[model samples]
Target: MSELPAGLHDDQTNSEPIVTAHSFLVQQADLEREAAEVLPGKFDECTYDKGYIRQPLYACLTCTHPPSNYQRTKPDASAETAPAGMCYSCSIECHTGHEVIELFAKREFQCDCGTARLLPAGEGSCCELKSTRKMLAKFANTKNSYNHNFWGFYCRCDTFYNPDDEAVMIQCFICNDWYHDRCIGKAPDEGDYEDYICRECVAKHDVLRCIDTTLVFRGVVADGVDRQVEVVDAEENKAENTEERPSKKAKTSACRLLPDTVSQPMDLFMVDGWKNDICTCTGCIKKIETQKLEFLLDSDEIVEPEMDDTRGESLYESAMKKLQGMDRTRAVDAASAYHAMSIKLKEYLRPFASAGKVVTQQDISKFFDEQKQQTH
Candidate 1:
C-alpha cells in the first residue's frame, strides 16, 4: 500500500473527506477536555476553598481592595479606593507568581487572582495592587506649584494681585497711573462704594445727571458736556434782529395773502393794493374757488338742513340739486364738493386692483363709451 501524507496511514487515507471528519472529532474531544479543566467545579464539595475565603463570590464582585496607603495621604483626601472584582493575577501579570499570591492575600478576596467573580450591577471594581501602584506613580510623577495660595480671596483690582486689608494702592480715574489711596487722601471705602462710577463720573459728570425727558416731558441737567456759555454782544443781537425783521415781513406777505375770490373785506383791507390785484389771476381764482367748495363740503349745515323735509336726502343728491339752481359762487362750492367726493371714491377704488379687481384698458374704453352714449 502507498504511504499516505505525513502523519497519516494507508487505512486513514480512504479519502480527504474521511480524514477531515476524524480530525474534527479529535478537536472536539480536546476542546471538551480543556473546558473541563478551566470551568468551575460542578459539585458543592469541589467548590470549597483550599484557603480561607474572605468574601462570597457575589459580594466579592462588589467589594474592592482598600486603596494604597499613599493615596489616603493626599491633600484633597478624595482619592478613589481600589474597587472589587478585579483579578490580581490579571492586573499584575508577574512571572514569579509569588508576588501575585502575596498581593492577593494582602488585598483580601478583592484582588483579581484569588477567585473568579462577577461584576456587580452599577459597581466599578479594580485590583488594589495595580490600582494603588498606578495612583502612587501618578502622585510621584506629578509636579505641584508651591507659590500659590489656593484659598486666598479674590481681588477686584484690575491686576487681580491680592493685597492685605490695609494695603494702599493707587486708584485711576482715566489713565493707568495709580495713586496711593492714603497718599491721595482718598479712602479705600470710597473706591469700593460703587462698581462703575469712578472713571465715567470724572470724565463726563454732566452726562451722568442729565435726566431723560422723553417720558416725563421734563429734563434736568444732571451732567452734560463741560462747555462755557459766552455772553451775547448787544450790537450783534441788534444786527441779527434787523436781518430777521425783513424776512418776517416778506414771509407774512407771501403766506398770509388770500385771493380776492375767497378773501373777506377785512383780508382785502389788510393786504397791499398791488398784492390784491396780483392775486386775481386764474390760478388764484381757481384756488379760491376750490377752498370755497371744500368749506361747503365740510360744513354740517350743507348736509343737515335746518328743515326736516330735506334732511332725509343723501348729501350728494341734495348738493347736486343745489348746484343746479345756485348762483356762480354757490355753484362753484357745490361742484367742488362733488369733485372732492369723486376724488375720494377714486382713491378708495385704487387698492381694489391689488385684490384681483384691476380695471383693464378694455374695461376703461367700455366705461367711457357707455358714458358717451348716456350723454347723448
Candidate 2:
C-alpha cells in the first residue's frame, strides 16, 4: 500500500486491505455527517418566487462557461456567455448533468435558471425547466450582482478556486467575494475579524475609510500596489452591486467622515460588533443617510447560517433515536443483535484487510448470504 489519501491510517502491513475498507466506511460516514451539518434542508422546491432572499447558489457551467471557470462548457464562437446562477433545486433538476460550481450562499439574488438570461423554455433549453418553472424573466435580474466568483474565480489574483487547496479564503461582507489573505496584502494570521470589506468595495464606498483604525486592521500594501476590481467601475451603470457603487452626485455629496489626509481605499477587516461603535451624532447621521449606510447599523444585514425545524435528520441518528424511545428490554435486545451482526461482518472482512484486498458491496452481500445459509 503506497500512500493513501489524507485521512487513512498509515500503520498497515498485511492488514492494509481491511484497514482500507474500514477507513473508507469511516470517511463515507464522516462525509455524510458533514453534509448534514452544512445542508440539512430539502432542496425540492424552486426558490425564485421567494424574491431575493439569501440562498445557496450554483453556477451552471454547462450553459455558460466561466472566464474558463466552472463545469462542462457548450462550444461557441464566443466565450462571452453571461454568467448565470441557479438555485439548489435548479442545480439538481434543470442542470443535473452539467458541470456545476457551488457558490454557497449569495444575498439578495433570484435564481437565473430557466430565465431568459440563462436558458429559457425552448428547443435545447435546460431540462425540467418547463416542469418547475418560475415565470421567465425577459432579462437578467438587474438587482443581482456578479463578480469573478460567478465565473468560478476568486481573489484579486483571478485564480480558480480549488476547495481542497490549503489556502484560506475569507468572504468580504459587503461584496460577498472571497479573498486569500496573502493576495489582499500582509496581515496577522491569528487576527480576529468577521466583517471584511474588500479593497474594491472599500474603494467604491469611500465612507468605510472613516472606520476607526483601533476597531479595524487595514490590509494596506504599498501606496502604489494596485488591486484590480473584477466588475465594472462606478463610472458605469452596470451593476456589480447596487449598494456598493454610487452615482457621481451621490459620491461627491455623501458624508465625508474621514480626514482629508487619508485618500486611498484599502481593505478593512472590521472586528465583530464594531457596528455598534459607528457614530450616530447629527453630522454622521447625515452621512449615513446620504450614502444609504443605514444597513451598516442594521444587524439584520449580517448573514448567518440558516436553520429551520424542517431540517432532515441523518439515518443513523434517526435509527438511534427510535431505539432510545423503545422500552428498555426491547432496546437492549435490538442493540445486542446489531452488535453481534457487526462483529460477524468485521470478521468476514478481516481476511480482505489482511490480504490488502478491496471490499465491495458484493463482498458484504456474500457474507450475509453465508449467514442466511447457516441459519437455514
Candidate 3:
C-alpha cells in the first residue's frame, strides 16, 4: 500500500501484526457497478499536458483550502485559499484519502496537483507521483473561472448539494450548473429532456433562440407537442411563391431564420442531436465567433456519456453472465443463492440507511463473516 495522506499514520510503538481481511468481494462488486456510473474514464496520467479543456475535476480541500475539522466549514474559504482542481488521475493517485469534493466535470481547466497553484498539503507537495508531477512556476491560473460550486454551493437557489436528496438535479448543457426541477419551475414528473439550457443561458445567448428553423431536427416542440422526424427534411420556405421571396432561399442566415427574441424567462429543452444541426455555414460561424462562444463548436463541450466499452463489466455482472452459461442444475443453485444473499444484504443495510449513518468498512466485513459462519 502507498503512504497515507498527510495527518494520517499508524504508530508502531507496540508492534502488532496488521492482518487485512479479504472477505468484502461482494460489496466491492456492488461499489464498482455504482462507481462506474459516476466515473468511467482513463486515469493513467495527469491532465496538465492537456491544457485548458472540459474534463472531470476534484477540489482538494485538504491540499488548498482545508475545511474546518469541527464538522464546520470555514466561511469564505474560496478567498482564504485559491480553489484548486485536479484531473481524474491526480484525484486518485495524488490526493487519495484527502477531503476532496468531486466537481463532476468542469470546463477549461488544467490539473493543479503538486503545482505552485496549490499550497503544499503538508511537508511536501500534494502529489504521490513525485518524479513526474510538475512544480509549475505559475501561482494560479488567471484564466480559470470560479463559481459558488468552488465553495460547495450550486444552482440559482445557491443551496449546498446533497446526493441523498430525493429531488433530482440536472446539469445545464449551456453553463454546466446543476439545478433542481422545482427551482427552474420545471415539474419533477416532466419527461426526461435530451438537453437542458438554463433560463440565464437562453436569454444571454441570442444564437440559441435563433437557430435556423430550416435545419432538420429529430425531436422538436411544435404547438406544445413533440414531433419526431422520420426523414431528412427541412421546413418548406413559406415565401417561395411570394414576390418578397429572395432569389436564394437557402442562403438565409440563422439570425434571419427566427428573427424574434424570447422575452420570457423559462428553461429551454433541446431536441435529440440538436448540436449536430447547428448551422455551420460561414455566416453562422462568423456570428458565433463574434459572441466569443467558440466552445459551442466543439461537440465535446457537452460531456459525453460513458461508453459501454470504456465502462468494463462489473464483477457481479460478470458472475451473472457466467452463471447463465453454466449447466441448468448449477445455474439454478447459484441464482437462488445470489437472490437470497442480496435480500439479506439489503435488510442488513436498511437500518444504517434509515438512520443516516455511514456503513463503515468494518461493518461490511463483519456482516459477510457472520453470513459465512451461519451458512457453515
lDDT per residue as tens, model 2, 91-197: 76667667788887777788888777787434544434444454564556777878778878888877878879887888887677888876776543344554777
Any runs in candidate 2 off by more than 4 Å, and if so which? Answer: 1-38, 67-79, 120-134, 137-139, 189-191, 223-260, 279-294, 299-376
Best by lDDT: 2
Better of 2 and 3 by TM-score: 2
Residue 114 in candidate 3, Cα distance off native in Å: 2.7
TM-score of 1: 0.14
lDDT of 3 by residue, 248-367 (tens): 313345334366444454466654445543555557667667865666666466233334453457676777778889999999998899899989888887776565554556887999
| lDDT value for model 3 | 0.60
As a whole number from 0 to 100, the lDDT of residue 262 in candidate 2 is: 43
- Candidate 3's clash total is 0
Model 3: lDDT of residue 253: 50
All models: lDDT? 0.29, 0.63, 0.60
Tens-digit per-residue lDDT, 70-150, candidate 1: 122334334433332223223322212221111111111232222232222221222222334323222221111111011
